[model samples]
Target chain A: MTMKKRNLLLSIIAVIVLFGVANFVQLEMDAYIRRIVNLCMIYAIIGLSMNITNGFVGQFALGQAGFMAVGAYVVGIFTVPVAMRPGVFYATPMNPAIINIYMPLGVALIVGGLLAALIAFVIGTPVLRLRGDYLAIATLGFSEIIRIVITNASSITNGALGIKNIPPLNDVRIIFLATLITFILITLLINSSYGRAFKAIREDEIAAEAMGIDLFYHKNLAFMISAFFAGIGGGLYGALLGTVDPKNFLFTLTYNFLLIIVLGGMGSITGSMLGAVIVTAGLEYLRVFDEPLELFGMAIPLFRPGFRMVMFSVLLMFCVLFWRKGIMGTEEFTWDKFVNFCKHPLAYFTKKGAHAE
Target chain B: MEFFQAFANMTAASFAQHMANGISLGSLYAMIAIGYTMVYGILLMINFAHGDIVMMACYFAFFGITVFHIPWFMTFIGTIIATALLGVVIERAAYRPLRDAPKNSVLISAIGASFLLENLANYLFSGRPMRFPDIPLLSQNIAVGGGVQIQAICFVIPVITIISLVVLLHIVNHTKTGMAMRAVSKDYEIARVMGINIDNVISITFAIGSAMAAIGAIMWGIRYPGITPMLGVMPGLKCFVAAVVGGIGNIKGAVLGGFILGLGEILIVAFFPQLSGYRDAFAFIVLILILYYKPTGLLGETTTEKV
Candidate 1:
C-alpha cells in the first residue's frame, strides 16, 4: 500500500479508537470527569480559533470573549424552550420577535457561529488597520463594550440575570464530534493556499503587501473564521454549563485561551489540542493550591482561595520570559514524523539538539 | 423639544458644578495618561502594568495610613517613592530582558506582569474594597458662587495636574538628563555611542511615569472615596485611550486627551441619563473612532514602516 493511503487508514483507525474510548468513559466516568472532558474539547476549539488570528494571521486581537458572548447569547436565546423565556427574562419580558422561535441545538450553534462571524466582519473592517499593541487594545475595548452592551440590553439578552437551564449538550459523543469537525475544517484551511497567505502576513506585513497579497481581505477572512469557531466553542460552553450571563464573557475569560495558546505553542494546531487538554485538566489539578494544605505537620498559610490564580499568573510570566516557544513551537504532529521518531529516538534527539545549536 | 427646554432651563450653578467635576476627573486622567505616553515614547511598548502599579500605590497608601498610622502627607510621599521603585523593578525584571526581543514577546510579558501584580494584590489584600482615609484639606466640600458646590480636592487636583505637567515638560525639554532621554528614545545605539547610559535613561523614564501613576491614584482615591484592587483597571484603560487620543508620545497631547475623555464622559451621562449603563463603552468607542480617522493620533507624528 502507498504510504499516503496507509497513513490515512491509520489516522481513521486512531480516531475510531478515540471515539470508542470516549464512549466507554461516558458510560463509566463520573459527572465531574465528563464535564472536564467536555471543557477540554471546547477549549481546544477556542485555542485553535485563537491560533487563526493570533498565530496565523499575526493580529493580536483579544476579542474572543466578545465573539464567544455573541455565540453563547445566540444559542441561549434560541435553544432555550419557549416555556422558559418568561422565567429567564424575569427582569424584562422576552422580546416579542424572538419569543416563540425555538431551534434545535445543531441549528442554534451554527446560527450562533454565523452571528459572531457577522459581528467580526463589521468590526474587523476598521479595526484590522491597526498594527501590534494598538490592535490588541482595540480588540480588548470591543470585547468590554460587548459585555457592557449585553449588561444593558435587558429586554433581549435578559441583562445581568442571564438565561438559565439551557438544554445541556453534555454528551461526550456530541462534543467529540463537534471538536473533530472543527479540527478537520481548521486543519484543511491551514494547509491550503490561503493559509500560506496568512503565514506570509505573519512573517512580514510590509513584504506581504509588496508581494500581491491583499492585506485587508485576507485579514478579515481569517478574523471572521476565528470568530466563527470561537462562537461555536462559546455555544458549546453555554450548553455544557447550562447557563449564560454577561459576567461569563468577561475580558479575563480571554486570558484563559491566551494561556492555552502560549502554553500549547502558537501557530500549531496539534499544539493547541495538546494545550487545551493539559491546561483544562491542569487547572483542575491545581485546585490543591486553593485548598488548605498541611506540610510537615503545619498548615501552610499561603494556600488560600486566591492563591491558585497567583501561581497561574506567575507560571504565565515565566513561560513568556523563558519558554516563549512553548511545547510545540510552530511544529505539528504528523504520521511520518511520529514513525521517524519511533524508529530512531537517538536521531530525533540529535536533530533537535542540532537545531538548538 | 422637551430635552432642549430642560437644557435651556438648567441653572448655571449645576453647569459649573458639572464643569468642575469634569475638570477634576480630566486632571486625574491626564496624570495617568502622562505615564502611559512617556513609557510608550521611550520603549515603543505599552506598560500594561502601569494601571496595576496605580492599584499597588493605593494599597501602599492604605496600609501606610490604616496599618502603620502614618500621616497622610508622609504616606503620600512614601507611596510615590514606593511606586517609583516598583516601576523600576518591573522594568528591570519583566521588560529589560526582552529589550531587543520581538515586540509581541515584550507585550505578552507586560501582560503577564500585569496579571501577576493584580493577582498578587488580590491574594495579599483579600479583594475587598477599603475606605480611603479622607484628608481634611482635600475631602471637604467648598461652595463657589451661586450655590455651586465642589470638593476642595477638585480644585487641588487640577492645580497639581498643571504643575506636574509644567515640571515634566521642563525636565523633558531642558535638563541634561532630559537630553539623554530624548537621545535614547530617538535611537538607542546612537545614544549609547554618544556616551548616554541607555539603562539609566529608561529607568528614569519609568520612575517619572510611575510617580505620575502614584499621584493619579491618590487623586483617584480622594475623588471616588473608596479603593479596591481592581480600581486601576477602568481608569488605566481609559487613560490609555486618553494617551492614544492625545497622540501617545506627545506629553502635552496626553493632558488634552485626558480633558476630552473626562469632560466627554461627564457630558455623555449629563445629556443622556438612559445611556449611563453604556458609560464605559464611551472611551472605547472614542478610541476606535480616533484610530480609524487618524492612526497617528491628534498630536502624534506619522512614521512610515520600513521594509
Candidate 2:
C-alpha cells in the first residue's frame, strides 16, 4: 500500500481498538474512574478548541471561559427535565419562553455550540481588530461581561444561584465519539486552505495580507469555530457535572486551557489531547501533595491544603522558563516518527541533544 | 421617577462624602495604576505579577505588625522595601531570562509568575481571609463637616498620592536615571547603543512600580482591611484598565484613567443604585468603549505599524 493508504488503515484499526478499550473501561470501571475518563475527553475537546484560536490562529484571545459559559448555560437550561425546571429556577421563575423548553442532550449540545458561535461572531467583529495584549485583555473583558450578565439575568440563568439538577452524562461512549469527531474535523480544517490562511496570518499579518489573505475574516472564522467547539465542550462539562454556574466560568478557568496548550505544545492537535489527559489525571494524582502525609509516624508539614496548587503553578513557571516549546512544539504525532522513536529511543535523545548543542 | 427620587435624596453632605470617597479611591487606583503604567512604559509587557506583589505587600505588612510586633510606620516602610526587593527578584528570575523570547512566551511566563505568586501566597497563607492589622491612626473616622463621617485615610491617601506622583514625575523628567528610563522606553536597541544599562533600568522600573504597589496596598488594606490571597485579582485587572484608559505608557494618563474608573464606579452606583449589581462590569465596559473609540488611549500617542 501507499504510505497514505497504510496510515489510513492503521488509524482505523487503532481507533477501533481504542473504542473497544473505552467501552470496557466505561462498563466495568467504577464511577470515579469513569468520571475521570469522561472529563479527559471533555477537556480534550476544550483544549483542542483553544488550540484552534491561540495555537493555530495565533490570536491570544482569553474568552474561552465566556464562550463556554454561554454553551454551559444553554445546555443547562435546555437539557434539564421539564419537571426539574421549576425546582432549579425556584429563586425566580424560569423565563416563560424557555421554561418548558427541553431538548435531548445531543440537540442541546449542538444548539449550545451554535449559540456560542453566534455570540462569538458578534463579539469577534470589534474584538478581533485588536492586536496582541490588547486582544487578550479585550476578550478577557468580554468574558467578565458575559459572567456579569449571567449573574444579573436571574430569569434566564437563575442568577448567581446557578442551575442544578442537569441530567448527568456518565456514558463514555457518546463523549468519546464527540471528542473523536471534533479531533477529526479540526484536523481536516487545519489541513485545508482556510487553515493555511490562519497559519499564514499567525506567521505574519502584513505578509499574509500582502499574500491576499483576509485577516479579519480568517481570524473571526477561527474564533467562531473555536467558540463552537468550546460551547460543545462546555455542554459536555455541564452534562458531566450536572451543574452550571457563572462562578464556574471565571476567567481563571481560561488559564487551565492555557496550561494544557502550553504543556501539550501550542498548535499541536494530538498534543492537546495528550495534555488534557495528563493535566486532568495529573491534577487528581497531585492531590497527594495536598493531603497530610506521614513517614514512620512522622508528620510532613510541607504537604498542606494548597500545596498542590503551589506545585502546579511552579510547574507552569518552570515549563515557561526552561521548556518554552512544551512537549510537542508544533509537531504532530506521526506513526513513522513514533515507530522510529520506539526502535531507538537513545538515538532520538542523542540527536536532539546534539542539535541543541 | 425612582432615579429622580434617588437623586433628590442626595444631601450636600452625602454628596461631599461621595466625592471624598471617589477621590480617595481614585487616588488609590492611581497609585496602583502607576505601577502598571510605569512597567508597561519600560517593558512593553504587562507585568501580570504586579497585583500579586500588592497582595504580598499586604501580607508582609500583616506579618510585620502581628508576628514581628513592629511599629506600624516601620512596618509600612519595611513592607515597601521588601516588596520592592521582591519585584526586582521576580524580574530577574521570571522575566529577565525571557528577554529575547517570543512575545507569547514572555506573556505566558508573566502569567506563570503571577499564578506562582498567588498560589504561593495561598500555600503560605492558607487561602483564608486575614484581618489586616489596624492602623488606628489611618482608619479612624473623622467628622469633618455637615455630619459626613469620613475615614482619616481618605484625607491622607490623595495627599500622599499627589506627593508620590510629583516625586515620581520629578524623578522621571529631571533625574539622570529618569533620562535613562525614558531612553530605554523609547527604543531598547538605541538605549543600549547609547550606553544605557537595559537590565538595570528594567529592574529599577519593576522596583519603583512595586514600591508604588506596596504604598497602594497599605492604603488599600487600611481602607478595606480585608486581606486574602486573591485580593489583588480584581484591583489588578481594574488598574490595568485604568492604565490603558489614560494611555498606557503615560503616567498622567494612568492617573486620569484611575480617577475616571474610581469616580465612575462610585457615581454610577450612587445615581443608579439599581445598577449596583453590575458594578464590576463598569470598568470593562469603559475599557471596551475606550478601546473602540480611541485605541491608543485618552492621552496616548498613536504609533504607525511598520511593514
Candidate 3:
C-alpha cells in the first residue's frame, strides 16, 4: 500500500530470487566461476574494512596489506597444520609452543579480525594524531614495516616460503552465505546511530568534535573495526587458498583496496559491495587485455598489451576529472530512495543505479 | 706511496667511503626531493602520483632506447618534456577540479592516479624487473686519489642537481608566475579574488615539479641500473619524507632535507649492519622524530592556524 512497504517487499523478493539463483549457480557452476565468486567476496570484506577508515572516519591509510599480513599470518598459523606452517616461516621455529593452537574455522576468522584490530589500536594511537596526508604516509609506513618484520621474522612468517596446506575452502555455498551475512550486518550497522556519528565525523571533524565526539577514540574505533573486518577477510582468504605467503600482502594489496573505495564512492556502504563485485569481475574481464585485442579487424596492441591497466587508469582519471563525487557520493539507500530508484530503473542504471536507490 | 700512506693515515678509508656514498646518495635524493618540495610549496597537496610519474619516465626511457630506437642524447629532453606535459595533464584532470573540495579528496585522487599509473605501467611494461642499458657516459670510472675511484656517472648527478636547483630557484623567485604561486599558497581565496588564474598557476607548478622528477627519474634509471613498476614507490616515498624533513614548502629546505636523509640513510646502514634490513625504517624514524621535534622542518617557520 505504501511506498516503503512496497519497496521492502520488492527488496525481499529480489534478495530471495538472487539467493535462489546463486544457490542454483553454486550447484552447477564451474570451478573457475566459483573461484571468482570467492575472490569477489574476499575483496568485498577488504573494501568494507578500508571504507571504515577512509570513507567513514576520513583517514588516509595505505598500509592495509600490512594489517592483512597480520591477519594472514595469524590465521594461517592457526588454520594450517603444525608441520606445514613450519615449512613456510621456518626461521620462526614452532616452539612446540603454538603447535596445538589449531582453531575452528569461524573462531580462526574472528581471531584474525581481533588481532588485526588490536594492531590497529596500537598503530592508530600516535599516528592518527596528525591529520590529512601525514596519516596516509604513517599508515603506509606501518604496512611496510609489518611486511619487513614478517620477512625478517622468518621464524614466525617463514619469510618468503609462507604458510601452506591451509585447508581448501572449495564450497562456494559457504562463501556466498558468509558474504551475504557480513554484507547484511554491515549494511544494518551503517544505518544505525553509530554510523551517523561516523558520517558526521567524515563530513566535518571540527564540527563533529565541537558536537562532543571524541575524535581520537572514534577514529581508533573506526580503524580497529575496519582492521577487524580486513583480518577476517584475510583469514577467509587463507582458508580458501589453503596456503598463504607474505608476498601476497604487498603494498599493491592496499592500492587495489584504495581504488575500490574511490571508484565506488567514498562513505557509501552499498557502493563498496557493488565496487567489490565489479572490480573482482573486472580483473577477470581484463584477460581480454592480455590477448591481442581485435578492434574492427585491426589487432590493436593498445587494447591488448598492458592495456587493461591503461584503461583502468583512464577510467580512474575520468572519474577524478569528470565524476569527482564517484559513483555513489555520500548518499545512502533509503525507503524513499528505493522507490524513486525502482520507478526509473533505466535512468538509475545510467547513473550507477541512483547511489543505493 | 708516502702521500697515499699519509692520506690513509689521516682519514679512515671506510669513513671517507661512507661520506662519499652518503653525499652521492644524498645528492641523488636531493634531486628527487626538489620535485616533492616544489609541488607541496604551491599546492599544499602531496603529489602521490609523482613517484609513478618518475617511474613512468623511466619506462618511457626504457621504451625509447629498447623499443622506439631513440638516441641516448635525446632521452633527457624527450622524457622530461613528455613527463612534464603529463604532470600538467594530471594536475588539470585529477587535481584541478577538486580545488575547493576537502583536502582529502585530492589526496585520494592522487593515490588513485598512482594506482592507475602503476597498473598502466605494469600492463604495458612487463611489470617485472628490467636491466637498464649501460650508457658509456654514466659507467666510466675516474680515480681521483690513491684507490678512491669516482664513477663518471656520480659527478654528472650533483652537477645536474645543482643546475636543476638553479633553474627552479630562478622560476620560483623571478617569474611573475612564481609570485602568483606564492600568493596562492599564502591564501587561495585572496589569490582567486586578486584575479590570478588559479588553475594555470597550479598546472605550471605541477609541470615544473614533474619536469624535475623526469630528470630525477632518468638519473635514477642510470644510477640504479634496474627498473620496475615499483621502483618509483620507494624513492617517491623517501623523497617525500625528505621534503617534509626539509620544511615542505621551503625549496632550500628540500635540498637540505634530501642531503640529510640521503646521508643519514647510508650512514645508518654503514655503521649498523643489523639495521640494513630496516633501511626503509630509518626514513620513518627520522620523519617521526622531525615531526615530534620540529613539525615545520629545518627551514620552515611554524605557523599558528586561524581556526
Candidate 4:
C-alpha cells in the first residue's frame, strides 16, 4: 500500500530472484548451456535494443537478425584464429592476430554496436520514410541483403563455410555480470527523456513529428541502438557457438524475435523480456517431437520430427485468437504493478481488463 | 564497326535475358503479390504469414502428389481446395476477431500465424529440403533468338498467368462478390451498414489469393524443384514488395510491380554478381524509394484516414 514498504518488498524479491537464478543456472550439465545463457542474454540485449525501434519508437523493423549477423561476423573476423580464417582474406597473420587484439568484452560489445549503428545509418536515410507494412518489408529485405553479402564475400566470410574457432568468452560470470549491467542501463535509458520521446513517436509518429521530435534523428538513433545491441548479441552468440554462419541470421531466425516481440507485447520492455524467455525455452522444450512417442496402441517412433513446430504453430494461432494482446498487452511491471500482480496472478497473466492498443 | 558490333551483342543479350527473367519471375511474383494486395485491400493487414502459407501450399501439393500418389491434375485440384480452405480457416481463426483491432495487433497475429505454419511444417516435414516433382506436361524448351535458350515452361507459365489474371479480373470487376470486396476495402463500417458480409468477402479474398499461391507454389516447385518449410520466406517478402511497389491496394499495380521486381532481379544478376549478394536488397530499396516518392504506390490511391 505504501511506497517505502513496496520498495523494500521489491528489493527483497529481486535478491531472491537473483539468488534463485544463480542456483538454477549452475544446474546445467554441458558447455552449451552456458553458451545458451550467453545467447539469451545477448537476445535480451538485442530485443531491448529492438524495443527502441519497434517497441518504444513504433517502427516495425525486421532487420535485427541482419544487424546481429553483421555484429557476429565483425567479431568473428576480428577474433577468429587467422589459421581458421582460411588465409583467404589476407596472408595468414605472421602470428595469431586475434590474441593481441582482444579488447575488454565491454569495449568489444560497444564496438559491435557502433558498427551496427554505422550500417543502420546508411540504410535508415533512404528507408525510414516508409510507413507500417512497407517499412517492415523493406527492413526485412535489408537483413536478407546483409546475409547475402556476407555469404558471397568468400574471401572475407569464407564463402559459407563461415568463420570458425573465434576466441570464446567462456565465463558464465562475465555473461551474467554483463547481462545484469545491460539490464540496468537499458532500463534506465527507457525511463529517461529519450525513452519518452520514443514512446511519443510510437503513440503517433505524425503527432511526434508535429511535436518537433525530428523523426529522422530519433528513428536512426533507435535503429542504431537496436543494431548495436543486436551486434553485441551476435558477438556473444559467436563466442558461445564458436562458429558463425551467414545462414544463421536467416529471415526465419528473425521470425523468432518477431514472435517474441509479438508474444511479449509490442512496445513493452517487460513484454520483450518475458517473450525472449518463453521463445528460447520453447525452442528447446519443443523437443518432445524429437523424443519417442506412443499414440493409442501403436509405438510411434522417436523424432517424428517437425512435430514441435506444428505444435508451436498451433500455440501461436491460439495465442493470436484468444490472447491477441499477448502476455502483457503493453503493460509494464513496475513495483505497484508487481504488487498487484502478486495479489492477482491470474488477472496479471490473463491481462484482465486489457484491451487492444 | 567492331565496337558497335560488340556493344550491340552484349546489350541485346543482357536486355533479352533481363526481359525473359523478369517475365518469368514476374509471373510468380504476380501470383503471390495478388494475395498481398487482395488482403490489404480488405483487411489492411500485411498478412505476415502469407509467405509460410505459400510454402505450406507447396508441401500440401507435395503431400497430394507424392504421399497420396494422386494424378498430377488431381494433385492440382486437391491442393487448390486444401490451400483455399486453409486460407479461409486462417482468416477466421487468427484474423477475423482482429478485424477491428489496431494495425499492429493484426500484424503480430499474422506473424504468429506465420511462425505457427513454418514451425508446424518443420515438425510435420523435416527441415531438410524436399525435391519438387517435375511436371511431364510442361517439360520442354523453346528458342527465341540466335544462341539463346529458354525453357518451354516459361511460355506455358505466361499463358497460365494471363488466364488466371483474366479470371481474377472478371471476378473483381463483374461479380457481385467483387462489389462487396471493393465496398469493404473502401470502408468497413459503411459496408456493414450496406448489408455486405465483410467476413464472407474477407474469406473469399483469402481463399482466392491462397489458391493463386498454391498454383505459384506448384510452378515454383517445377522450376526450382526443391521444397523447404522456409522456401516461402524470400518470395513472400519480395512479392509483398512487388505489391507495394506497384500499389499496395491495387491489383493491376501488384501485377506490374511483380514484373518490375522480377526484371530488376535479373538485371542485377546479369550486370553485377558482386551486387548479386545483395539481390534481396533491391526490394527494400525499391520499397523505400517508392515510399519516399509515392507512398500510395504506382497504382494505389492515397488512403483516407478515419476521423
Candidate 5:
C-alpha cells in the first residue's frame, strides 16, 4: 500500500480508538480525571491556534487571552438559559436585545469563533503592518483593552461578577471530536498554498512580497483563523468550567499558551498536541509542590501554596535557555520517521547531532 | 457649555492638587521609563524582566527594614546594589546565551526570565501585599496652601527625577564610559573591533538600568505605601508605553512620554469621571494611535530599513 493510504488508514483507526476510549472513560472514570482529559483537548485547540500565528506566521502576537475572552463571553451570553439571564446580569438588567436570544451549544461556539475572527480582522488591519517586538506589544495592548472593556460593560458581561450556571458540556467525547476536527482543519490549511505563503512571509517578508505574495492578506488570514480556533477553545473552556468571568481571561492566561508552543515545538501541529497533553497533565502532577508536606513527621514550611507555579516558571526558563527548538523542532510525526525511530532510537539522536554539527 | 461649567465648578486648589498628583505619578513613570529606554537603546530588545527587578527591589528593601531592622538609608543602598547585581546576573545567564539566537527567541527568553522572577516572588512572598515600611519624612502629607494636600514625596520625586536625568544625560554625552555605551549601541560589531569590551559595557548598562528601577521602587513604595509581587506588571507595561511614546531608545523621549501618560491619566479621570473605568485602556489606545500615525514617536528620529 502507498504511504498516504497507510497513513489515512492509521488516522481512521486512531479516531475510532479515541472515540472508543472516550466512551469507556466517560462511563468508568470519575469526574475529575474526565475533566482533565477534556481540558487537555481544549488546551490542544488553543495551542494549535496560537501555533498558527506565532509559529507558522512568525508573528509574536500575545493576544490569545483577549480573543479567548471574546469567545468565552459570547458563548456564555448566548448559551446561558434565558431564564438565568436576569440573575447573571444582576448588576444591571440584561441588555434587552440579547436577553431573548438563546443559541444551541454548537451554534454558540461557532458564533463565538466568528465574533473573535471579526475582532481580529478589525485589529489586524492596522497591527499586521508592525514587525517584531512592536507587533507583539500592540497585540498585547489589544488583549488588555478587550479585558478592560469586558469589565466595564456590566450590562453584557455582568461587571466582573461573571456568569454562573453555564450549561456544561461535560461529555469527553464531545471535546475529543471538537479537538480532532480543529486539528485536521488547521493541518490542511498549513499544508495548502496559503500555508506556503505564510511560511514564505515568516522566512522573509520582503522576499515574499517581491514574489507577489500579499503580506497583509496572508498575515491577516492566518491571524483571523487563529482567532477563530482560539474562540472555539474558549467557548469549550467556559462550558467545561460551567462559569465565565473577565478575571478568568486575564492577560496572564496567554502565558499558558505561550509556554505550550515553546515547549511543544513551534510550527509543528503534532508537537502542539503533545505539548498540550504533557503540560496539562504535568501541571496537575505538580500539585504536590503547592501542598504542605510532612517528612519524618516534621512539616515542610517551604513546600506551601504557590510553589507549584514557581517551579513551572523555572522549568519554562530552562526550556527556553537550553531547548529553544523544543521537542519536535519543525518536524512532524510522519509514519516514516516513527518507523525509523522505533527501529533504532540511538540512531535518531546520532542523526540529529550530526545535523547540528 | 456643559464641559465648561464642569471645569469651572472645580476649585483652583483641587486643580493644583491634581497637577501635583500628576507630576508625582509622571516622575515615577519617568524613572522606570529611563530603565526601559536605556536597555532598549543599548540592546535593541525589551528587557521584560526590568519591572520584576523593580518588584524585587521593593521586597529587598522591605526585608531589610522589617526583618534586619536596618536604617532606611542603608536599605536604599543595599537595594540598589542588589538590584544592580541581579540585572548583571540576568544578562549573563538568560540573555548572553541567546545573543546569537533569533530576535524572537531572545524575546521569549526575556519573557521566561520575567515569569520566573514573578513566580519566584509570588512563592516567596506568599502572593500577598506587604505594607511598605514608612519613611516618615517622605510619606507624610503636607499642606501646600489653598487647602491642597500632597504627599511630601511628591515634592521630592520630581527633584530626584530631574537630577537623575541630568546626571544620566551628562554621563551619556560627556563621560568615557558613556561614549563607549553610545558606540556599542550604534554598532556592537564595530565597537568590538574598536577594542571595546562589549560584554562589560552591556553589564554596566544593565546595572545602571536596574539601579534606576530600584530608585523608582523606593519612590513607588513611598507614594503607594504597599508592595506586592505583581506591583511591577502594570507599571512595567505603562512605562514601556511611555518609552514608546517618547520615541523608544531616546531617554528624553521616555521622560516626555512619562509625563504625558501620567497627566493624561489624571486629567481623563478629572474631566470624564464616567469613563474612569477605562483608565488602563488609555495607554494602549495611545500606543496603537502612535504606532499607526507616527511610529517613530515624539522626538524620535526615523531610520530607514536596509535590504
Candidate 6:
C-alpha cells in the first residue's frame, strides 16, 4: 500500500480505538477515573493552543490562564441553569441580562471560545509588539488584571464566590472528540503557509520581516487562535470541575500548561497529547508521595503533603536543565517515524547519544 | 458638592502623612528594584527567583529570631549572608548550564528555579503564614510633625535605601568590579576576551542583588508582619516592573520607577477610596501604559535592533 493510504487507514483505526476506549471509560469507569481522562484531554487542547503562540510563533506569552478564565467565565455564565442563577449568585446578583441566559454545553463552549478570541484580539494588538521577557511579563500582567477585574466586578463574576453547579461534563467522548478536533485543526494550520510564516518568525524575526511576512498580523493571528482553543479548554475545565472562579485561573495555573508543553516537545502536537496524558496521570500517581507512608511501621518523615509539589518543581528544573529539547523536540509523530522507531528502538537511542556527544 | 466637600476635608497634615507613607513604600520597592536592575544589567535575564530570595530571607530571619533565639541584628546579618549564598547557588545550578542556550530556555530555567524555591519553602515551612519577628525599635509607631504618626521603620527605610543606592553607585561607577559589570553587560563575549572573569562577575552581581533583597525583606517583614512562601511573587513582579519602568539596567531609573509606583499606588488609594479593590491592577495598568507610550521605559535609552 502507498504510504499515504496506509497512514490514512492507521489514522482511521486509531480514531475508532480512541472512541472505543472513551466509550469503555464512560460506561465502566468511576467518576474519579472518568474525570482524569477528561482532564487529560482538556489539558491536551489547552497545551496545543498554547503551542500555537509559544512554540510555533516563538512568542513567550504567559497569559493562558487569563484567556482560560475568560472562556471559563463565559461558559459558566451562559451554561448555568436559569433556576440555579439565584443560588450561584447569592453573594451579589449576576448581571440582570445574563442571569436568565442558558445555552447548551456545545454552544456555550463555542461562545466562550469566541469571547476569549475577542479578548485575545484586543490584548494582542498592544501586547504582541513586545519582545521576549517583556512580552511574557506584559501578558502575565494582563492575566492578573483580568483576574483582578473578575474579582472586583462582583455583579458579573458573582464576586469571587465563583459560579457553581456548572452542568457536570464528565463525558469522556465529548472531551476526547474536542481534543481530537483541536489536534487536527492545529496540525492542519501548522502545515499551512501561515504556519510557515510563524515558524520563520520564530527562527528570525528580522529575516521573516525581510521575507515580507507581516509580523504583527501573523503574530496576532497565532495569538487569537491559541486563545480561542484555550477558551474552549477552559470551558471544558469549568464544566468538569462544576465551578468557575477567579482563583482557578491564577498566573500559576498557566505553569501547568507550560510544564506540559515543555515536557512534550514545545512545537509537537502528538507530544503535547502524550504529555497531557503523562502529566495528568503522573500528578495523580505522585499523590502517593504526598500521603503519609509507614514503611515496616517506621514512619517516613519525608512523606508529606507539600513534598509532591517540591518534587514536581524538581522535575521541571531537571527537564529544563538536562532534557532541553524535550521528548519530541519539534518533531511530529508521523507514521513513518513511528514505524522506524518500532523497527529500531535501540538505533534511535544510539543516534541520539551520538548527537549528544 | 459632596465630592467637593470630601476633597476639602483633606488636611495638609494628612497629605504629608501619605507622602511619608509613599516614600517609605517607594524606598522599599526601590531597594528590591535594584536587585532586578543589577541582575538585568549584568545577565540580561530577569532572575525570576529574586523575589523568592526575599521570601527565603524573611523566613531565615523568622527562624533565626524565633527558633534559634538569636538577636534581631545578628539574624538580619546572617539572613543576608545566607540569602546571598542561596542566590549564587541558584545561579550555579539553574542558570549556569543554560548560559549558551536560547533566551526562552534560560527564562524557563529561571522560572523553574523560582517554582522550586517556592515549593521547597512550602514543603519545609508548610503553607501557613508566619508572623515576622517584631523588632521593637523598628515596629513602634512614632508621632512626627503635626501629629502625623508613622512607623519608625518608615523613616529608617528611605535612609537605608538612599545609603545603599549611594554605595551601589560608588561600587558601579568608581570601582573595578563595576567597570567589569558594565563591560560584561555591553558585550559578554568581548568582555571575556578582554580577560574579565564573566562567571565571577555574574556571581558577585547575584550576591549583591540577593543581599539587597534580604534588606528589603527585613524591612517588609517588619512593616507587614506576615511572611508566606507566595509572598515574593507579587513584589518580585512589581519590582521587576519598577525596574523596567525606570528603563531596566539603569539603577537610578529603577529608583525613579519605584518611587513613582509607590507614590502612585498610595495617592490612588488616598484619592479614590472606591478603587482600592483594583489596587493590584494599578501597577499592571501603569506597565501597559508605559510600555505603549515609552517602550524603552521612562529613563531607558532607545536603540534600534541591528541586522
Query: Which 10 successive residues of model 6 chain B have the least lDDT summed?
Result: B1-10
The lDDT per prediction is 0.91, 0.92, 0.80, 0.78, 0.91, 0.91
Q: Between prediction 3 and prediction 6, which has the larger DockQ?
A: 6
Stretches off by above 4 angstroms in model 1 are: B1-6, B145-148
For model 5, what is the alpha-carbon lDDT of residue A201? 87
Task: Return the TM-score for candidate 5, rounded to 2 decimals.
Answer: 0.98
Question: Tens-digit lDDT track for model 2 on B1-307?
Answer: 8878988999989998888889988998999999999988888888888889999999999999999999999999999999999999999999999999988888888888988899999999878899998888898999978888999999999999999999999999999999999999889999999999999999999999999999999999999888999998888888999999999989999999999999999988998998988898899888878988998899999989998
TM-scores across all candidates? 0.98, 0.98, 0.89, 0.89, 0.98, 0.98
Model 2: chain A TM-score against the true structure:
0.97
lDDT per residue as tens, model 3, A192-275: 877778888888888998998888888888888888888888888878887888788878778777767777888888788777
Q: Cα deviation in Å at residue A278, candidate 3? A: 1.5
- How well does candidate 1 reproduce the true complex, by DockQ? 0.85
Candidate 5 CAPRI category: medium
**Structure candidate 4, residue pairs in collision:** A55-A267, A113-A228, A306-B122, A306-B123, A307-B123, A309-B119, A309-B120, A310-B120, A313-B116
Once model 1 is optimally superposed onto the true structure by TM-score, how far is the C-alpha of residue B277 displaced, in angstroms?
0.9
TM-score of chain B of 2: 0.98
Q: Find the candidate with the highest DockQ and give its number.
A: 1
Q: After superposition, how far is residue A33 of candidate 5 from its true place, in Å?
A: 0.7
User: Across residues B1-307, which tens digit of lDDT does each residue of candidate 1 receive?
Assistant: 6567557867888888888889999999999999999999889998999999999999998899989999999999999999999999999999999988888888889888988898899989989889988888899999888877799999999999999999999999999999988888778788999899889999999999999999989888888978777788889889999999999988999999999999999877776778889989999999989999988889999988766
Q: Cα RMSD for candidate 6? A: 1.5
True contacts kept of 3: 0.53
Weakest lDDT window of 10 consecutive positions for candidate 6 chain A:
A93-102
Q: Which 10 successive residues of model 3 chain A have the least lDDT summed?
A: A82-91
